[model samples]
Target: MRTDLLILAGFVAVGGYLFSQVWLSPGDRILAHSYNDHYQFEWFLAVDTYNITHLHNPFFTDLQNASVGVNLMGNASVLGLALPLLPITLLFGPSVSFLLAVTLGFALTAFGWYWVLHRHLCAHRIAAVLGGGFAAFAPTIVSHGNAHLNLVSMFLVPWIVRFALRLFRTTRPVRDSVILGLLIAYQALIGEEILLMTAMALGMFVIVYAFPLLPDLRTMVRPFLTGIAVAVGVSLPLLAYPLWMQFAGPRHYDSLGGLAYVTNDLNTLFEYSTTSVGNLGGTLTSTNYAEENGYFGWALLILGAGLALWLWRDRLVRTVAVLGAIGLAFSLGPDVGWYFERTGVPGPWKLFVELPILDSMNVGRFTFLTVVALGVMLAVATDRIIKASADGGVKRAGVPLRLVWAAALAAALVPLVPLPLPATGRPPVPHFFTSGAYKQYIAENHTVVPVPALKATGDMTALTWQMATGMDFRMPEGYFMGPLGPDNIATNEPPPGPVTSVLLDVAKTGKAVQLTSAQQADMLAELRKWQADAVVVYRVEALPQLRETLDPLLGSGRQVDDVWLWDVRALTRE
Candidate 1:
């Protein structure tokens, strides 16, 4: 069969399995919040393309305007996975784009596993498949299915390693630098925190491999410098939006000391029991090894032991040792007491500026190193084992003899160990949109709400900060959860479109404001003072006020879209 067909078949089989095991029931799931952000990002990407191509601006400026890019959520405008989503949507339409992205992602991950192992072991196909299989369906991948594009982006690892090794050997600066640079840039564009972690790991790998090429610094220097250049060049496009936000964005933690506690999130540590033997599912949560099964599957442990044995007699032991050490450190960092102290409370390495980069990565996801390292080790060990066994005078069985033995085994065990068939299921219903009021409007209109231009009046409250920041949306720069009020809004600004609602926290009360009849009138008066579109009642108590104010506004303006209208004049004219 052609490789394309084989690859397609593999993707279909794996995708079918994942959909059945996770999406079909309550048996395997997490809260919607766990994955909603990432999935929503996918939607943002599709919407953003329409925004950028037509509007020329990246923000959703007006609530009433539905043009793409004009009034985008600034936090969401950074084009994280937006580029990847473009081609998939164009090729397969929006409905299948997400599934295609996952398919391609997992396929690349599997291929990466294959490439890493193939380099270590000559041509051991079985071992390569098994290692890739383990990685593609690893627990961390499943746990982070909804929110983590960078974590799932591990599919790029194998290609990076292979290219780096090739560069190390050939000393081709331009080629090596270009590939490495592109990969790093891609990482940065995805998200800054993950990009920083990946850079650290790659740097460590280079240092380890550098020792071997030390005799000729000329080769090493050129490639390294070129790689940096390439990385900078590829990342240039992203410079306009994200880099400045690294320092300027609202930071919850001020010091490295705070990161230790904030990133640890204790609940994650005890979610799974360690006792589930041979389980590798604890990557998301640091559950006990004995209760939730071990995060390192038995196969991984076996490979690690073999790798250790190989190191004692092997010339390339340094490579394995370096990779293993990095992997082990990340794996044990959360469990051990020393790592906890070192990462916090003024440890030696904490002084470096790059330490902030590492800290920002949050310690839990150090598992990428472990998975890649294991793939390499599994490949080498499995190859050695299979070769040694096969070449040791084990006679190849005759065709007839093999057939007879297989028939006898099938004949004997047919009833006891029956082969299970694949389960059938319906297509997935998009829970993300279906439950919301916006879903109905989107379904009826068949297009996402167009964001208004900056020059136009618009509402900014609908957007979350993450979305707003990405788009570079320049409206009332408020956060979904924040300490400050909407003080970012300009004093003489025009009405910010038809008011859907307003969130007012009165008197710093822990309890939210419930707008009463008097409050509703007062709120509308306030909006009118700001040259507002409509008055918003944020709470249930404010509902009556909202109804009173909105009923008049609705009468004056024609309903342009579901949320709000352009204006009462436009409605009267229509």
Candidate 2:
């Protein structure tokens, strides 16, 4: 117990060190590599906190998309985590809460795997620590740690795996099924994509593990099927509504298009990630800093293969190896690429690219299953080494076998040690929001149309400002994924209205255009549709031009507390 506490403390220390940049000044600094996703998640936390406190619907909000509203369940809102951390968000603000979520997310995930390995798999505690550490802090996991709280909060995964294995052997199938069902529901609320991937991986494992024991499967089939049925019965009731809201309710989207093209390059499987200690010159591939999902390094890959070969007799080792290989193949996506060039080779994922749930996922994340496979292999190998050492040791060619194995493990892992995530100082929220000045100008549930309004692709500063105000005012056409086009496919930004398109163009080009009377009438009509109360422009390079552009439609604006505002309640009022 004492040793477990120490190991957990070590994990926490590592997690804290990795995020110390934002931890020191949560509100003022942001993860540079998050690329505005930090603002999006902070907005999620703030809105969830506000909704919970005010007794509003947590699944939908008019806060970002204004009168049209955004379906929170359709987005990666992470309400499962947000609701639990409400006190922290309420006290220290969402920035602090966001940071805490990522920081502790890593620690808790590591500890969860550690507990699983020590209690069920490895005989030695240190072996479990190594395996668990790799499972949680692998390069792929660290990449998502940039701003993907939904992916980072994986503490439930190991427990889910443990319970799943128990179901195959448990006498008390009813009790175990209920527990597993509850866990599945919670994990679904956290990140349904992750849960889906886990289910796929578990299914593959069960198939592979049961193949050799097919003759005895008849004995295990009854309990396994019964437990699965009961588990489904329990989880469906808890998840039915939220699942409906996500897929069939207001603002629901069919699927995100073009994600099938975003996949891992073949070389990514053996290269070092930018965040890893072993990176020589960084990657030359097209993957962005946050999407380097398969950089396992050559040493780890070779070591994993060697370990699997050495333990070939063990069914578990063979099962994990097959799983990892399949996952790696799938991660290559529809067309396999070699040295960042398309090879025109169809990978396994090509067959499933158009499937309902799979279409929405970034296929490169299939490498997550590979990470789990490697962790299991490491634990099993380490257990063998410890047992060999204890039982008078196995010698090969008179070499010190234990010492050689230890050195080999270190060689594989040392290069993969993670570096601190990059961060930069974020601009402070405008005084207009912090002083609560907007409340006086904007009526309840009325929109504040920000100049250069939050779009899917660029500048999300407005989101931080809205979060700073505790989501007190609504905004039009903000950064969030929602249904669009004839098919209602998922798009990051809603279709821009006539006025919004011109504002966005001005914000992008810094060139003002004169609006004719007809255009002004269109702008007014759009504002009326939004039920807009005010149009506020904060710090932006095109502020002057934007003001000139809006003048004809909104009349001359007045300066107020580091912002220019035009109160349009008269024109927009019903």
Candidate 3:
């Protein structure tokens, strides 16, 4: 086998090894986040089913965040992602397809960077392989793998960089630019936020790399700008309508309450997540499971710092080091802090607080660049060691520098390696929903109301139920993003009314809520406004209380299989 293909196969093995549990037991329900991934996978299933059956707008679905519904264009619809996997999802289910996608995501991301390094950036195959490993399997990316699939699908970032460098390095800059544009369009379909972040990093790379060759840059400027324009033009067809719908469509909302809490402390860079195979794991500092990206491990960061100092004159090293510094600073997100103390000082992120799209972005995710930068630096250091050892003119006390750097890299990797992700139990869905029995309760134009509306902390049973029924009927208060109060931040779950909120609490906590006469009247009014076709409550903890509470508003309900069903069409019409 060719060396590049051999390295790619090795990466595939690594990815497979990491996610073996997911593939081996596909039936066992799993989620990276307690709620998000469960809904995300089910959402993919719902959209796939929609695409298979109907010739309609897949983006405008009343199935989730029902009534007004959600504008998927404004949300992480991931439509393009789910489309190609229609066969796999239809046959084995979304869980199996999701696992496969994730495994491939890792492998492809690693290989993309390896291609760039070996073919473009570095000459040493070993250094390129190591760089690919870091770029693809960093602790930061793994931390996001807990729930964020979009972030994990980052194969295009390196590919974009590879082609972007071609704008400067090759004679065929126009061809590279057109391909670069297509890659950007495809990547946006995968994860626009990551693409945006990648763009920022590359923009920094261009400025730093161009400064030294000022006269050469003037000569090169035409092709590079033309390449960018061509890329944007190429992407317009794929992105134009979606972007138009996102900003202008109904049920869309602005971003709010973002990044304030998830920002990294200065010390977080030095600390490692409990998942890392580092000495300081779980000891130095901590953040939310998804936000545990600040760590680059002490060994790697220290070595990268030493390398930056040694190679200050080298444009690539300086660019990477500066990029890492920028990412770290930006990820601080308005606040400056040490390990335990908040200095209350402002960070560079404060400048971006009011900046349109930047406001919504999770500034903490910028730590991704720091991890990438460190990996590239590690590869460079390895290459330098190899060259020094080969030349024999540069040696340390009769010892080969190659052996010294090799040992150091091994030491760094030992602490930076991450533990595999684990799976968890999914709540049971009733045969009534899964076996298409729901068709009896809800008709073509009607919406089913699941009592105790879907919320993140509680079970989002209705979403799975809808998916199981092949989305035969729409449901109110489902897990999706739609417009919300005051500032209009896009909320994940629909805003439940007073009655729904009370019942949701009962369902989740087994705690009863006392209802007053006025409250009872208000709940009834809200239910009528929904014009609900049917109501079903299934697999709940406080069924008796829910039954007693709702009996006053809408007579007794009949039990069918595992669910209690109430036909509310007559009353809702009245």
Candidate 4:
């Protein structure tokens, strides 16, 4: 018990160190590499809290995308974590809540895996700790931790794996299955993509593990089938409505197109990630910092292969090796790449790329399964060494074999130690919204048109401002995923309206275009269509140009508490 507490404390310390930059000034700083994703997730936390406090529907929100709304279930809302942590958000504010969620996410995830490993796989506590630490703080996991709360808070995964393993051996199938079902439902609420990937990995592991036991499979088949059926029966009721809202309901999309192409380069398996200690300021093959999913480094890769060969006789090791190899193959996407060039070879993922749920998945995330396999192998090997040493059988030339093993493990892992994630200053919310001064200009059920407009990409501080106001007012063309066109294809943000397009152009180019009479008329028509009550512009890039663009259409504007405002309620009144 003392050792477990120490291990948990160490995990928490590492997590705190990784995010210390944001924690130092939670309200004023954001993860630098997040690329506005921090704004998106902060808004999610705030909006979820608002929904719960106001007794509104949790699955659908009109706070973003205005009257058109956004399907909350269709996005990575992390409602399971958000709803439960409402008190922290309500007390300290959403920024603090977000920080706390991510920090505890790392600690709890590591601890959960430690508990699982110690109880089920390892006799040596240190072996479990090392394995769990690697599993939770792997390069891929740390990379996602930059912005993804849904992916970061993976404490439930090991528990799900534990219950899944029990299904093959348990006498009380009904009770265990019910528990597993509840876990699955909760994980679904947290992150459906993560749950899907985990299920796929588990299926692969089961198939590989059970293949050699074909004759004995009959004895396990009945309980396994019964457990699966009962688990589904329990989960379906809890998940049915949310799943419906995600797939067939209003604002839902069919698939996130082109994501399957974001795959790992083969060289990424041997390269050092930018965040790792081994990074030497050279060419990095990853798509971006957040997607450095397979930067395991040459040392770890070689060590893992060596461990597999040394422990090949063990059924568990053989299965884990096969699973890791398969996972690596799948992560290469539909077309394989080597040495930063396309190999023109069809990868394993190509076979399943067109399947319904699989089509939506980012193939790069399959490397997560490789991380899990490596963690398992590490724990298993460490346990074997400890047991052999205890039995006085692991000695080489009168030197402890464990000493040599520890040095080799350190050599593999020390280079992969993560650095603190980068952070940058956050733009402060405008006083107009923060001081409730906007209420004087805008009416309820009317949208505020932000200058340059909130968009799916580029300069989304408008989202932070909206969240600061407790989502008291709505906005059009905000950052979110929603269906577009007749086919309901998923778009990052709704197509920008005419007024938004012009404002965005002016914002980007820093030069206002002279609007013709026809263009002015069109802009006004769009304003009326949006039910716009006011136009607010904070300190944005190319502010003068934006003002020049808006002046002709809205006639004039007045400075009001760190913002320029043009109230259009009179023109839009029905």
Span of 10 residues, lowest total lDDT, candidate 2: 280-289
TM-score of 4: 0.97
Q: State the local distance difference test value for candidate 1.
A: 0.42
Q: Give per-residue CA lDDT, model 4, range 228-252, as digits (tens).
A: 7898899999999999999998889
- Indicate whether candidate 1 or candidate 3 has the larger TM-score: 3
User: What is candidate 2's local distance difference test score?
Assistant: 0.86
Please provide TM-scores, in order, for all candidate models, with all chains considered together. Answer: 0.61, 0.97, 0.92, 0.97
How many clashing residue pairs appear in each of the predictions shown?
A: 48, 0, 1, 0
Q: Name the runs in model 1 displaced over 4 angstroms.
A: 1-8, 20-35, 55-80, 87-95, 119-121, 210-294, 297-299, 302-306, 312-321, 331-354, 392-574
lDDT of 1 by residue, 196-250 (tens): 6556676777777566667886767665556676656755664645444433433
Task: Quote the lDDT for 259 in model 3.
Answer: 26
Model 3 lDDT vs. the true structure? 0.75
Give the distance in Å from residue 257's predicted Cα in candidate 2 to where it truly belongs.
2.1
- Ten residues in sequence with the least summed lDDT for candidate 1: 413-422
- Model 2 error, position 301 (Å): 0.8
Whose TM-score is higher: candidate 1's or candidate 4's? 4
Candidate 3 wrong stretches, greater than 4 Å: 32-35, 259-261, 279-285, 339-341, 390-395, 508-531
